[model samples]
Target: MAAQPGGRRGPARGPSKGAAGGQARGQVRRSWLGGVRDAIDGLVRSSPARFAILVFATLVLITTALLSLPLARAGAGTGGTPLYDAFFTAVSTICVTGLTTVDMATHWSPFGNTIIFIGMNVGGMGVLTLASILGLVISRRLGLRAKLMAASDTNPSRVHAGPVSERQAVRLGEVGGLLVTVAVSTLSIEAVIMLGMVPSVMAKGHDFGLSLWYSAYYAVSAFTNTGFNPNPLGPAEFFDDYWFQSLMMLAVFLGSLGFPVIFALLRTWRSPRRWSVHVKLTLTTTIVLWIAGAMTFLVLEYNNPKTYGSFGFVKTFYEAFFMSTMTRSGGFSTIDMADLYGSSLLVTDMLMFVGGGSASTAGGIKVTTLAVLFLAAYAEARGAPAMEAFGRRIPRDILRLAVSVVLWGATIVAVSTVIIAQITKSALDFVLFDVISAFATCGLSTGLTESLPPEGKYVMAATMFMGRVGTVTLAAALAAAQKRQLFRRPEERPIVG
Candidate 1:
């Protein structure tokens, strides 16, 4: 234990040149890593929208890899899931689209199912929502741009709601509270629903483990409005249980309302007057659509024996309501979708087209977009220059955005239908329904999903990704690097009806 270096006993050298050189190289390596990390962080901050899309894409790729693992599957016909099937399922689950090429319970091992569960949770909760939450947990701090990115990505209606999450993130306002509220509110709602669901699931399964798993799975799925039926029998098995159906209905309804509404309601339960106009419009419109869609289904499918002829009036009513509830991005079906009267399919298709609210796990052009467009039309008909809603004047930019989203959505649905129509040669009605479902991120199907060719599956998979990230967001990510125009051409109006 002699002293080192310049100590009298050893008179050791300060350092060897080789050791010094190695230390210098290690420092250089560390510096290089730090530079790479900083560059990535800078890129993400500058283009938060693109970064968010990239993050979701990366997550989808990870999910695809995990699901394709041989260990992730049960010993079925093949040792592992096929590449196409795995890719399709990964996109579906991570997008919370719920479209499945294979049966969930029968085809997937426990590990595979868990992977799906985790992916749905991550996807169902906005990707940026999870990212910001993780950042908060790890560093106890987050950037303004990061919060603004989450706000825009989740709530398209708030795309121009500048610095809402940012300012709030600094002062522990709604956006700041959102980081915790997202996780708490989600689990809280799911837990209550799960608890209520257990006895019913248990009665049906007669095994505690089976019931618990089903309860937890359904709680997560329903609250996310993903409508995944892990039940081997499919969701139809619970059709007779009034209590189970009621709980599910509530979960799907609330989940589709989106986090902003949920948080507002939770924060100011008694102050309905203080609720944001977004929440007010969303609730009113949702209730109206639900009732309207339910009545249409009840009238058209009431006597269709395959769908609801045997059910009593009350049961039929439940099924009708459930059907309508599901079409708003919840994919569960109490009866076969194909057996529904053609008129009912049309109704469901329209409902899917006008999906749930912005910032919700639900997808489509979004309820707000439709409401804005219709409101603008009404105002224009009356000769009012501007659209008004809930005593707030709608901005012109928002109108432009709404129009863009609707047109973009319509174009996608039309193109997708044409492509799949040729590939499957399925009936136009069925093809249109499935195409809209894929684009809306609504997992409803016409029994044609499994039969689609590889080409068609890939088409649907890409559509699902676009729907989840938003067509506009995808377009933005790709075009964001372009320089903004500093001048504009003279305006001109084209003739219209």
Candidate 2:
């Protein structure tokens, strides 16, 4: 040892060099991690859409990896699940889009099924919403940016430039309560649905334990609008079980209504006048679509012989109603979708394309979007300057956003259908049906999904991802990439359609 500057004696030189080197490495690692954390936080604060997409994509990747494991597959020594199937299933599960390339009942092990169950619940909770909830739990409160993001989950327009109106589906100050509502509502609703279905499942010849498992699976699937069946026979086993079908329909309807609407209804149940315009529009439009779709189905398929024709009037009506409900992102079916008339398929396509409510587990352009567009058309025909719904004049910007969402959704569906159609060369009708199903995340299929080529599956998987992440959110994320201008270009009318 030797004397060192400002020290009595030198620490052993060899040990000192190693310790200094270790300290430098640790500092570098800490700095790197800190940089990564800052980047993530910056993303979360800057654009909630991109952050939500990143989180969802990461979740899908993790789910895919789990499903790829050998243990995730059924049958001893069957080897690891195929990448295409695992990846597709991962997207389907995490998106709560139940389209599957493989048989749900025979393909996955218990571990795999558990992963799907958990993933569906997580995915059913909107991505931005889950992130905000986690942030609130970790930090004991949400920051301004976190609240803004959560508000965006409830109202996509909240993230737009300019001050948001106090009138919102879920306001900034109420974001914390909204997050709590999301968690509490999801768990409570699912539990109730699960309990309700257990006895019906037990009556279907299963023991209490098996019935409980099936009931729990169906509860999560139904509420999430996931459409997965644990049984070998699928929905066919319950085609005549009115109680099971009714409960399932109830769960699907509630789940499709979106959390904000649920929050609104719960808060304003006593006073109908206190209900927000969004609540009014979503409920009215959804009910109208449900009934209209049922009638259309009954008309189109009543004489098809293979479908509704075999059943009597009551059975036909019930089945028509069930199918109509399922088409709105519910994904369950009691009969073969391929057996429907072409006209019925076209009608189903229209219904599924409209999908459920905004910020809900179900996807598509969203019911609010359809309502806004329809109102816009109605107002235009009346030569009105603004769209009005439930006595509230909808702003032009909201109309613009609604149009953008529908256009974006239609474009995505068209592109996906063409790509998948080119890949498989299947009949155009079935191909279109399944493509719309994937794009809407509605999960209905005309036997096209299971038989799609690998490339087609990939396209459908991407479609499902886009549909679940939302057209509006994706558009917002894209728009956020551009720098904001201090001035606007002069508006000009181009041409009439």
Q: Evaluated with lDDT, which candidate comes out highest?
A: 2
Which candidate's TM-score is highest? 2
User: What is the C-alpha lDDT profile of model 2 across 343-430, one tens digit per residue?
Assistant: 9999999999999998898888898999998998999999998888778888899988888888998999999988988888888999
Residue 24: error of model 2 in Å?
A: 12
Candidate 2: regions farther than 4 A off: 1-37, 137-140, 160-163, 480-491
RMSD of 1: 3.9
What would you estimate as the lDDT of candidate 1?
0.81
Least lDDT summed over 10 consecutive residues: which range in candidate 1? 163-172
| Candidate 2 lowest-lDDT run of ten | 6-15
Q: After superposition, how far is residue 12 of candidate 2 from its true place, in Å?
A: 27
